[model samples]
Target chain A: MSHPGADRVRDVARLAGRSARSKRRSFLAEGPQAVREALRRHRSGTPTVEQVFATDEALARHPELAEPTDGVTLRRVTADVLAAMSDTVTPQGVVAVCRMLDVGLDDVLAGSPRLIAVLCQVRDPGNAGTVLRAADSAGADAVILTHGSVDLYNPKAVRSTVGSLFHLPVVLGVPFADLAVRLREAGVAVLAADGHGDADLDALQDASAARRLAGSAPDDEGTGPRLEAPTAWLFGNEAHGLAEEELTAADARVRVPVYGAAESLNVGTAATVCLYASARAQRR
Target chain B: MSHPGADRVRDVARLAGRSARSKRRSFLAEGPQAVREALRRHRSGTPTVEQVFATDEALARHPELAEPTDGVTLRRVTADVLAAMSDTVTPQGVVAVCRMLDVGLDDVLAGSPRLIAVLCQVRDPGNAGTVLRAADSAGADAVILTHGSVDLYNPKAVRSTVGSLFHLPVVLGVPFADLAVRLREAGVAVLAADGHGDADLDALQDASAARRLAGSAPDDEGTGPRLEAPTAWLFGNEAHGLAEEELTAADARVRVPVYGAAESLNVGTAATVCLYASARAQRR
Candidate 1:
């Protein structure tokens, strides 16, 4: 791929836009980290990467990326060509065209997911990705972005995930009405992470810890929802937070305590706390 | 103020640059939320904001901003002029010229702070601001940026803080060498948030909780550092993480457990969990 303006390069670059990505059922993952992760997923039998384009310099620097994988086409391209095919100003001389990896909500539910993160109307791609990465770190079973949430395949989001997108199952465009009912049927408690919620997260964690320390079952004492139970946390839009309907749909609205003068926690920071709290409780 | 090309407008816009900000000892806080917080700080006797420039629509939309305040110059500017005087493409019709709020490390240590977040060699502006905001959410007493860290007063960083910059004390440009000795002298344990640390954050929290539930002293059982103790958490660079010197300087290196396939947690996320764990334990 010598020409920066070639039709193939243009086609790969088109994945930067939503309509193009939707039509092709694929998105571009730029930089060595994302491309490396994509190839790893492909090697793991996920069929994630259709094609990987890299400059010689990149392949030289990351020799592991040069190893060929089945059904994944690796092409050497000029740095200019790679640049032309990437969304970021510096794509680190590598890009991968990968299949859209979001799985069905039913498939995720069938896995008996112990910890799930459902993003409700989270409009920022970076925030969505941050939450997704945090969820992966917390060992979440899955992440669901409800209808009206930012597109998980947005390049900035894919970049922000820092390869976590390839690490877990993501379900996109889920309807809140259906999701709440389905989650309850799956025996998962839907908890809304609200700023003004009556239930406090720290208190819940404390109760869970006390029970565990006393050799009692996680749910032996608390009438409220237990952090140790199968749970799905709903994080809302960065600006407006969880809507009234969404709040009411949850089993409980839980607020992360703010001991400082901050008006509220950023959605990503709050999600990390909520998800990690559940992860710790459930693991214990 | 009506002229977009006015020298005063240019001077205000120049604050987006570090040299200008350093020379003037001020920075620009754009959008309503930051301006509101700056005004609130000023009203509360901090004298943070010097001038607030807003459009008629912004003033009308936020009538509370129109309230009279001592020593604050409120000027109505044309939208074009406001844009010219702002860093963001859309400043949301308002911007404030605020004093540089970072304090000396000696003054911060003098307060005998319980929880602090120290950023060492973190270069990304957004990451710096995100950590600052997370520290605020976790109710940390102060945030310290080491010598090589990003400028917290960068326009994007200021915007990323979302008014939290005005909420707490920040110490900037402190040498790690001096900071470590001062923190030790102040009786604050310096814990490095390292990915490969021997001490697990969750385990520390569990021990803290067990002690609390058992009505025992926080430091009774463990040879390890207690999360309930007055502490300073050292967060490192996004790319290379904490240097060997930084890791060795800490009394203990603590790692936030990554329960899943995520190679590591983002520094901001790690900082949030560490700080909140300390806050919860100390408060208990």
Candidate 2:
């Protein structure tokens, strides 16, 4: 059955994306686990969830949704309304909209971070999410998305993160020019992964033996050996790879060694390897 | 601009999936690279491609579609008709219905082989495709997908392979019961990846001593570092991972060591690491 405010529901759904354009709000907070995490970390110690739409089936499945809250708003919507609002194929039966958290560069880099991931022009939403999830697991401090990268709020991208989007701090919309300046200013060395590089990953790991790299760092760079500083890795687009301009801006160019048949690796897989390698180096 | 035979075109498009159920004739070929790869391989003596379809635009873009050959039926469809028949959001203007080639266990092991990948219950079409692509790049001799894995002819899976599916031999629908017997007969040992294993990946690689230990003969059944024969590396499902029964069946259970916070590597990333490690060992 159609609802009374079908147009309103559709409008809210569209608002998920256009919020950035229309209201200057660019992020979306979604999924049950994500919603819970968002609630747990509210500044007021009580998250003011702007809206809540739940189904009888969903509420029964997750009774926690029925819990009373002081500042949170509550409402009931048909499955169709929730479906219309959902970006994923199967809506997890819960979603929330809030102002995007503006995590400052200084705050994200407060300490001498051992690991950081810099994403350059990664176009696939799923790849972007997986990269973030990997970085979260590796205990990396932040993920930097440069120009031409897919938006992190793209629903498929958010779902792929499996709640990691909330756990970690992500900085997006930074141009390559700004990233080079900002990261360099923060003592972050940029290492871009290219297929043709002089140094092998194994030797590079040995070079950065003092730092305790964990979670994800930047992609490995340099001609001789491992990354030796507080590094930020640069990953490029799947098809075009790292642009020459971006590659030239990097402190080093590194590659994962391969043998025999394959010419290259998938962008996501390559990023994961480099991040994990840096983590291993730091641990040593 | 509706064509007279538009109904038939839509009917054919819908049948792509259902056709496999009845006729067991499923074909998923798209993009310029995929269609071109099919044409090149079929012309070079592989008898897989049964027919080719193109629009006038596609024919102009890829003149190779005009090549004459017996048993290769070339059909012309309108651009709209081609769009109706396409599975991708952006059709390459050319597609082909290729006969599925099931390279058998004996066929893949015909020569003294070095590297191979065996996927068990890997459900994601994209992950399966990447594994096949990685296998091809790593120069693996063959890729085998056990029952319960994603269908090899899935359109999403085919697209993710990026034409690498044509370069390497892939075998699907093999039951573990049959695979166990065939692997034993071929003098191949199976090593399954586990998250919580006794030793780390580096230790396992070091123990293999650069694959020099993977000599001509299989080790004694169920004893000491297990069989070092030409190996069959098994990858499990994305969520629950390898079942206890499946993990126990392997010649050895191995894990990729993690630092910091990642719960585990994404399924495709893990498969690539394990496959590349084995390939590296074989080379040594």
Q: Which candidate leads the pack in DockQ? A: 1
TM-score of chain A of 1: 0.98
Give the lDDT of residue A43 in candidate 2: 38
Error of 1 at B206 (Å): 0.8
Runs in model 1 with CA error above 4 Å? Answer: A1-5, B1-5
Q: Report the error of model 1 at residue A2, Å.
A: 5.5
lDDT of 2 by residue, A255-282 (tens): 8765534557777767776777666555
Cα deviation of A14, candidate 1, in Å: 0.9
| Candidate 2 residue spans exceeding 4 A from truth | A1-12, A20-26, A36-52, A63-77, A198-229, A257-263, B1-15, B18-26, B59-76, B202-229, B258-264
RMSD of 1: 1.3
Report the lDDT tens digits of candidate 1 across residue range B115-166.
Answer: 9999999999889888989888888999999998999999999999999999
Name the docking class for model 1.
high
Provide DockQ values for all models, in the order shown. Answer: 0.89, 0.35
- Residues B1-284, model 2: lDDT tens digits: 23437675664466358365237464858877787777777887988677666787888888877788667877877777777777887777877777777677778777656567888899999889888877876678889888888887878888888777888788887887667557756777777778886657656544454234334343333333532347777888887788776787777787877554455776777776677666655553
